[model samples]
Target: MGAFTRYATAGALVLASLPVAASARAASATAAPAVTGAARADVTVPEAWGTLIAAGRAGKRGIAFGDCPESEMLPESLRCGTFSVPVDYAHPFGPRIELAVSRRAATGDAAERQGALVYDPGGPGAASITFPLVGEWSAWRKTARAYDLVGYAPRGVAPSPALSCRRPEEAAGTPTDAPQQPSYAYKRERIVLARAYTDGCVRAAGPALRHYSSLDGARDLDVLRAALGEPRLTFMGTDQGAYVGALYATLFPSHVRRMVFDSPLDPDARRVGYRAGLARSRALESRFGDFLSWVARHDDVYGLGTTADAVRGHYDRLRAEVSRNPAGGTVGTAQLQAAFLNAAFYDDYWAMRASALAAYAQGDPEPLVTQASPRPYTAKGDENADAVRTAVECNDGVWPADWRVWDRDHTRAARQAPFAAWAGAWANLPCASWPRPRQDPLDVRTGRGALPPVLVLAAERDGVTPYAGAVELRRRLYGAVLVTERDAGSHGIGGADNACVNTHLETYLLTGRVPARDAECAPHREPNALALNRAVPRGTGPQHILRGDPAPAGS
Candidate 1:
């Protein structure tokens, strides 16, 4: 499909919209050691770059000592250190890329400690300072409590030499998924921003942008392992983070131990763009249908219509209303698209949407405004987001390299899913306009070779990384087991009951055992009593709107 405008309409629950082309792409802490007096696992560098990389590739490990540079250290459980890795792995020592490393020493008790397990938070762009502190995520606080938790920023990311924009606040505003159509003028603005962002990074980051992909990032992780003094690498990845974990396993199979990949990214879909990018719209349409049913039952809450169809009609009219006029000239397509993108992620905003509907009906946009400009993280330069997003994605693989190819694909996808068409394309406008040519993206493929079993979890209908990706990944890795969350469909394992998922997850981390075979856990729909509009299940009722937990799912 060629790029077009994103129009949110009530169709057969799913419709395609055109997408613009050009845009391209795109931690934990440890605790004290349990055994202090025991001999430290002896790890020594051969003092030769070839020896080090070779041994690492061969799965013969090395010991990690204190961090590289004191200045870069994070004042957390894990002390910060830098290791010398080749700026380009092919040219070790020619120029060096600093691998920012952090480590929480073993609780000083060797017997109780299961060794170091490094966890990676996704973003290809989230700093990895408190990775070990993610015990709460794994349901293995006791088990992980013993191992050293470690994390490091990817190259050109924070905690490393970090790429730059003029300011950090550039990251503000809800990052509404840019739809894939040209009708939205924001499409053109986004392209300009992406180019400007890349220019700034090039000026500031120098040559670092060339080696910031998962290929090199995976290499950096190996270097982290060598410095930390571990026998093997144990890791956990979520969303796009899973891709990193999968690649690590592929590149350093012997060193991989007990990898737990949550919210699996479908690298296949990533290779063939339409599947992964459009899954959100498909998932949202299904979930929105559910929301409309709820809205119909709570007719008093939103007087749009009594039946689900009526509720949908209300939305259809609302979309057209906003598309043509917006709320009393206060809201526009960009603002409305942003709100819709954010709202579709969770249930916390039904009332907000209801309120917006009520207000828009009366020509007000405050409800929509509140959502359009959400503050999910500390804001950095909007330029930083634009740069970081493009730098990573554009470098990972060649996007269309041909806008015409992108146009055909997007036009096709939009006809099937109008809600996200333009917005999705806009999110990636940077790739289309990227200044650099991309290498073929890494496959992150793992053939049927038995690996030390790992735990892979996914919500069946996850909006970002579809559950099928988990299944595909499991088949790729020799012994990996995948557990499906039937009803949960967002990040953090769909934020479900947590009991069943946790029980299995903790067992794997604590005992190194896998479920008998690939399995599926029952779906945990947000109970009506616990329904909060957000993807996370943290706060219920109005409190839900106030607290954010389990961060939003990413593409």
Candidate 2:
């Protein structure tokens, strides 16, 4: 995994699994005919769902709140707690697991207080318990004040009996040296690592590994909604988190008040893992081009090249040098690729990344090493983040069991997107040997006229989720309005300080006003070193800074 591993590793699983229809339908023949455009009055909420909510409200087996573990970065007003849910929802009283949750109450006047606004921060594994704090400190402050910002560590994330595969001590070492061109030996080593990681997960989590799919996370969300006493959920899910929100809306259409999907995953591509991975690789290639152009524009500072091709040549040579001998005994070809791949996610890192690359080329590897440093685990359970990322993605859909298929697809992809194709392939290869039986991909297409108008935000050049995913999500969710950030490649759209995007987002969250038709926003000015340094909050890492967090202490 690399610096942007959480986002980049979100490729698809197997393409052969059956598709589970996620849309909700009226349970009675007497129900009115389905409406077309506006919110329908005909859809009926299931009685069983009502009964479940009642049981939770009566405190029979509902979530309980308590003081959160103290964190100076977080306000004392935030509440943290956990609730038990069946590992297999079908067996409601069988084996159970706890879901860690956090809530920041509305700061606005009680008269203007809206319901809770739940958020999922992209990675199938990204811990969200700290998202409320992120909102409080970023451009989302107004939205956070009006609605109680709700966050939860989806099953198998930190503080929730996380899914750990290997201990830090058991971590495998990657080859310090690689040939200029990828060799069969390199591919074989990658497969061995993938299989070893998969086996470790099987040993660590046992049968529960099969239950950590996105569908399962959506079910846990419904339980949280019931416990919170909210009639409907207002949600904002980014990246893979967008997949969870889409699935949730499809499963409980009548219970969705407002929704936003930022840099959304393509629900239609869930069954075809290779197709999705290829799309992401292409997007990465395009974004890398953008990065190259940016570097060329600032040739005075970097002194690498005056054109994109020249800069790319320098990059190629640097990569080859590192592959021949790992810089500082750690920065190999993979680490170098990871650092640059992360820079492609947000242009805010462009100057820093370019500076590091320049320094590395000048016989100084320390700066690049700092940029490629692994995010330290903040809690005992935090170590399982990657394991959960693997388990959820692997269990989500059927992956090609044959390595030949992966080999062929990634090989083809590398021709056009050499930067990320091979890296993404190895990152997702664990699914080929995942221990559990694969679950069917959810049919995220909403029933006509079922869901309310959802607001979709996307950067035209976003590589992680890609712009096309937002388009596909709009088609899947009827009446959804999409707001595209023209010429922008940043992955997270909301709260990124783009007035156009944030205005659209804030309007929808505050008053449920969606544009009559799809809209486009001009991209914000590109970040320069001076501006970025000023924009980034104190005491946060580069990743957290781009994620709109004020501090790096929380999940």
Candidate 3:
């Protein structure tokens, strides 16, 4: 249905799985002691947002990130441009990385200019270029529009050098159960191929791959700020991007203006080793359980089962059979399991899940194949899945160089989750054998300057950022608030249009008044069994059926 899985990949391992993901921390630097979970219990809210200690104005110019959607175009006042940054900040002159950057200036009378508002749309790989152009309605957009709204693609990501594999063969191995597809003989073959593919990137990535670290990625944001000629930067980051914000705010505290990170990632988790990855898998399953339960109740939509337990057993058996004998030569346990990866993100995607299940029950290979293809089906499909994901995810933290740990955890996850365990492992395993030596991730605690504190948002049930991880970021950051959306699910934060979270986000984004105390949002109800929005006569309104962003003020 699309090129690459949704950034909202379900933890294809672990079971309710004990919440394997939320509490992850980045690996720390040499001697900085790490903070304990307890320290995060206290949350801080800042004063006013974008309260100008100073001012700067901009000319009527649109910064280009890429061509705007053919549908959207503004003359000079708002444009797009690319900023050339040091691939490795330490080596400013050697190799340059260009960030696809964009900006939309304040409405009128430029003299009372505030500052620049930059955004990161999660996904160590999601696109942020369109953010500013579309930011007018964001809860924070009014304040942001008070200045310039800036956007940039991370290194190795789209519009940015775009790490890609060129072809599926580059991804290697046919789809089949890990055991049956690989056999012991195939395992040896895969090992060789994996090493070769990773090796190719080492030679090809040039110096850019080494610098894609969040810390370096943060530097890229700093470069964006410098190019804007702003004294400081006001940033808005969601999900994985929160990690980017933390690293930047910490690294360039004096350069920081006001920052807002929704769906925070643990800085320590980003800097840590394999153990955190495995733990997050379990946390992810808890989020998935909510999905499974919803699926069971809707037995009519998907005949998967009538009860949650039965639905689990059914999916487990279905995938296990494919492991032993792929339905066709094409679909295997990994591919089948990977098909459901988006379940961890939005409840709206349950439509995709129902489709996948129905296709499996019919034993059709099309749905599975579509899900498995890392790129797309054009004359020249996408290759970035392999390169971009690996370049950023792998270097961000050190995966245990040992296969033994991966194997042990993979086995444990298979037993516990049965559905997603091994599949996710294979989807991301190339990193284990990557050719380049790993860079130690930065704990990113640079609370040494005058950056205004930030507001961090997270849902308690989010499998990705996890409530615990948001707490962690608050602890490590100099002056950041951890405002919990107590009962939501998936990777929601700034990404949500939910009024519950949106109000808090809006208040903080509008002015830097975070809830004086840590707050809890109402839990999200699962996907609509019936439509929830205002009635549109059949397809009469907003022709597209997919749900709009959940954040009300923004969406």
Candidate 4:
């Protein structure tokens, strides 16, 4: 069958299966995480929360909405505003910082409307305010019509109180890519550079650096929830935001209503040092295997190879050649891996990634060269984006101070998942010397009654936040139902037109019911591009460029 026909068939199957969604939920609930543990006779909010709620109740000031600075670029209906939140929650009346917030009122009937559905697209550094403007709106719009869609720029991110790192001119010349089989000299240089980066962030942000952790972001969410006048918080946190939401639920369980965590981070991994590294390494390796299969299937078109092993060998040879000699002194082995690794996360770009690789191998280096060049940092608030990405991760939990910890972990991980192991290590190296007190990773446990019925989504072959993390998160949050998109390749799974996943999401949002047990969404074959001579669709709008930031690769 043709690719279009295949996709249509998948759509039909997805639709035909929806009539059983209610029964499916019942069937799935049987397999869901045990929710019988956290049910205490006296479930209570902390003293801090009670105080904040009291303060909010007394103040009587509603959220102040104004013309969004980006309104000209956005649809007129989405309003934007800012509110002062304490730099430190403990010192509520002390130093204050502004938070950027945007809201799109519900389009559904006002009588049936739920409260605001706050969203965090998870970069820890990614501006949440941008989600309503640019993210996959249709996926949630069905339920969003009755509820306000709200997004925010967390502290130390763009347009809020953004943080900065005083990067030196010489620092700009340092190679950001992971050096393959580095010599002792190279290792020493890397250590020095990592120290410099950390120092620069400390110098630029000062004490503010300590206030940018995920825990702090969660607190900020409470403040936002109060400002919006919602009695309880309804949220959707993806990627790192999953950790943020998890922390919020742990810190203020009674305040949660409906929550959705997609492609979640393992709360356990976040607290310790380098544990997430292993998870990321394995995820990348699994994705690499998927890429190999794709290339093998299209050997007739690309002439790379007709077997998975042969395709992998061809790739290994190409990468090795590039490591020895970068093409046009731009696309090095690391650069090539970085560029195409995007394919492992989202199948939408596989055709382009493959075409670029095939072209590079045939001696035209422009495709790979252009794909690998770093984004120009001239965009507004780009430096702050870097600062927040580093600060939050560094302060969130203790990263081992000793270089040997990374050395041991990266060396072991590289042996198995070479594509991203060392590269990820170098990407997150700044945490080693971060000039802030390291908070111990939170032991985020969810007992039976600890939280509301949450929905967790995961793609089996996720490249950044691994599927294992999602499973672990589901188990920790007792009663949470996990929706797995089997063999789906995207880092974020909700963007596609998958009825199985969307039905669960909309149902849970509209009625607070989930599939009773864990469930799976059948994978749909990605639509293939036409021949090389056909005009390829250009990627438009704002794309997420989070290279060398906190994440493994993608969000």
Candidate 5:
């Protein structure tokens, strides 16, 4: 809602849930082309493409000619390359931008290998080029071997003409309002900050801002599909990546072969889909209750409280104390909330978060601070990550331009999900004043057109792209089947360790089948609580950065 956490890494695993497809078939290389460049079929290629085409085709693989960048640390089997496409699809052959792509060839028998599986790891901002790391995810190992895995840097993200504000430090700044009732001055400060950020983004990104939306990314995917010599796209998208996949399907249904939309955003077609943010706030509040219950049950271990209210009281007290005297002079109430919100996103982190909180209550807060510190916004090449996130979201849909709307909504949500509502609102405040013209939100239903059966997976307790949104997507796509992981408090269930979910996922990726009906699966057994707690040594700050991904919007 406010900002999706960058939580797609690590615990983002998929498992078996729905029954495996009845049959499996290897994709044929000779499948008829559905529609080449349907995404840009109406546009006329400019003369400028002639020379570019000749040079691109000079190599062994015409149009697909590319070699891995020397800078990339990837397996020898994976190849990387760059491709040029028009900045604006309608004006093909106009100004062009190069997008970086990495490919892992299918490991299955040559005859059984399917088309490339283009992936978008959500953040709308995070680099998808990290597919090499997917091996550790386990759930995707079979998928990785079954089809060529494709990862690309979305336009405006780093390594693809990233757009960073000239005042990178200011552009990278994050609003740090603690979880409390905001004073009039605090509200005004947010407004001013939002204006400043919007202005900086415009100065930094210039015309590039208009082409960074998910819609544009979808079109880019089609272009990449053509370049790969694929008849249709086979995609695996998680988090906001799911949103891009959904948009691509809606915009070019005939061009999709198979798609997996995991932890997807609700395909509500509205310009400025701020209501989804509200929906996420409600989900977070719901999961927070679960955290309270778990903490209460483990009171003997955490020593925080025996009742949920008592546990919550300890949290509130710590927040008040931090507000008065910021913990370690580095951590404040806002940082504390951000650090702990990770617990609500993944149950596996519950004990660690509880341990951090218990340590804070006993007068050591450094562990929490280390976990919640704002990400290094000014890191080289990353100054524009936040900016790209803002631009794409703002341009894709209309965020209410009026402060009053945001104030009312955030105020109501904070009452329940105090940990994230306001902070999330502040995360996207730049959208209110985004200079780009907003496009109407897309209606991603597949009922109007022919679309292959698609798969949608969600966790019953995901706070980022809540389960409700997944249900909505399942309903909108006539042939889509929804898979749920019961009691799994996670954002990306597909990448989770649940064997059941992984089995189902494998069946789908390897075969072209999903269960005929919507289905649910049990959560993977949690790790030993005592073991998890023991691992978080007592009376010491975290030795490394305890980073948590903010749940992304749309996806």
Candidate 6:
């Protein structure tokens, strides 16, 4: 089908599914009164959604505790199951898909049990089936003990019907040796690759491509909520997953008991496709400056440089070298960019990343190669994660149809913000030629007092899902109390061992008492290289914890 036809079909399906009065209310944002807790009963769910919830409950089955290939590393206490959801909620009786789910029962007595705390760890495509296992070592430990911890691999992730577009080797195309100011030829080549990748996804998934959006994921969450026999949902999501939680609460306002969003996506900025990427690039540039300065201060240990510019100069040389010759025959410019881009996510990674760069400069590429290795969640050559991320992001909002628009915007961004501008642009380039039509961005703005207060945690300088997004989300969601970790720069905040952030989060989760006003907490102490070098084992440190990798024994 043509793009326009697909757009109309998808739009029509969604509109047809909504109750006429709710549709009208949605169209006129002002028509709905401020729905406070006392008036929450007035909120009504769409008939289509109610039907799906009913169907889900009827089909709900108990989770069976068993061994699986991926579960060996997971805690044995965790149990796995599959929850059936329609591939296309627009057509509820249509082809169905199963979401892989894992659950850890509350450790506390029956009276202490609150409800299921369904969690999603950030990536639109990140595998979350192991989250319950990981939560045991995370800041969620207290919350996990009091509530049943639930994790699910959203549709199109492994153990679910995954979307695969290319093989691992083919997906990692050769690195470009283009200058920071890329040539027009490089831009054109990127567009070609984007189109080819989009075409591959179209050929692989066909009509189902349009269904893999955050909107659909939100609907799936409601279904999962019903299957668990919960009257309301208690959710925690980070990064892009935060966007999913926001969408869910918007669609099912009355069903939300409590929710938390860490490092949230700006729903408003995300609708304007390029704006989100630009914001991310600028944040990365600012955070990169911080990383450079930190390394400069630790020059005695890293010996890279003693000034920020000097450190950047050394980095540029490394990039140039890697562009020409892939480190360890695999860590090329692409892998190098991916590796350093992570530093922007968490400050804890600064020391390790600096150490890796220093080692690479001295002709030992092993550490750099290992640092750039594919993350456990995206280990399928990252193809599935990349594909799902592309699908959700492209389908979530309207991307510029004309490639020239993207070329112009990114070229300008690259000039001002050289850190990851082009890399971010190319990572999302597939959207320029995505096979599916873009849907109108969901209107998440609710009437004042529409829902219970939400807790938003953000770091002052978080690059991935910048802090500004948390502010935007707080503004959009009425009564959302934002807890800022002043001067910190971590993507996921609650579980990084910040006593201040964790206390507020734990307090809210245990008792629904939000701070009378928004609050700020001091940033965690910076990593100490000397102390770290002497104390930390070879590979285990804050990097693994921040990355959500399996913890070391006794962690």
Span of 10 residues, lowest total lDDT, candidate 2: 1-10
Best candidate (score: TM-score)? 6
Ranking by TM-score: 6, 2, 4, 5, 3, 1
Give residue 406's error in model 2 in angstroms.
Answer: 1.2
- Assess every candidate by TM-score: 0.73, 0.85, 0.75, 0.83, 0.83, 0.86
Over all chains combined, what TM-score does candidate 2 have? 0.85
TM-score of 5: 0.83
Over the stretch 1-555, how does candidate 6's per-residue lDDT look in tens digits? 011112123433343444744543442232122323432332343434433433444234534545544533565787777767766655544456767787888888888899899887757777566666545565667787789888787878665777876665664544435356778888788888889888887877788788778877877877777667676789988887888898887877767889999888988844445678888898999889889999999999998889999989888988888888877766677677776776776676677788887887778777776666434433452777788888888888678879878878877898879887888888888887887556777777666666788899999998878888889899988989999999878778876658899899999999988898999999988877641222133324332433333321111
Largest lDDT belongs to which candidate? 6
- Over 242-344, each residue of candidate 5 has an lDDT whose tens digit, in order, gives 8999878765677789999988887777523587777777888788778888888887788888898898898888888878777666567766676677677
Candidate number with the higher TM-score (3 or 6): 6
- Candidate 5, after superposition: displacement of residue 65 in Å? 7.3
Instruction: Point out the worst 10-residue segment of candidate 5 by lDDT.
Output: 20-29
The list of candidate 1 runs beyond 4 A from truth reads 1-51, 54-84, 97-110, 136-138, 164-181, 184-207, 269-275, 278-297, 300-332, 346-367, 374-377, 381-386, 435-437, 447-450, 494-497, 525-555
377-396: candidate 1 lDDT, tens digit per residue:
53432334345545766676
Cand. 3 TM to true fold: 0.75
How many residue pairs clash (N, CA or C atoms closer than 3 angstroms) in each of the candidate models, in the order given?
89, 2, 40, 12, 29, 0
The weakest ten consecutive residues by lDDT in model 6 span 1-10
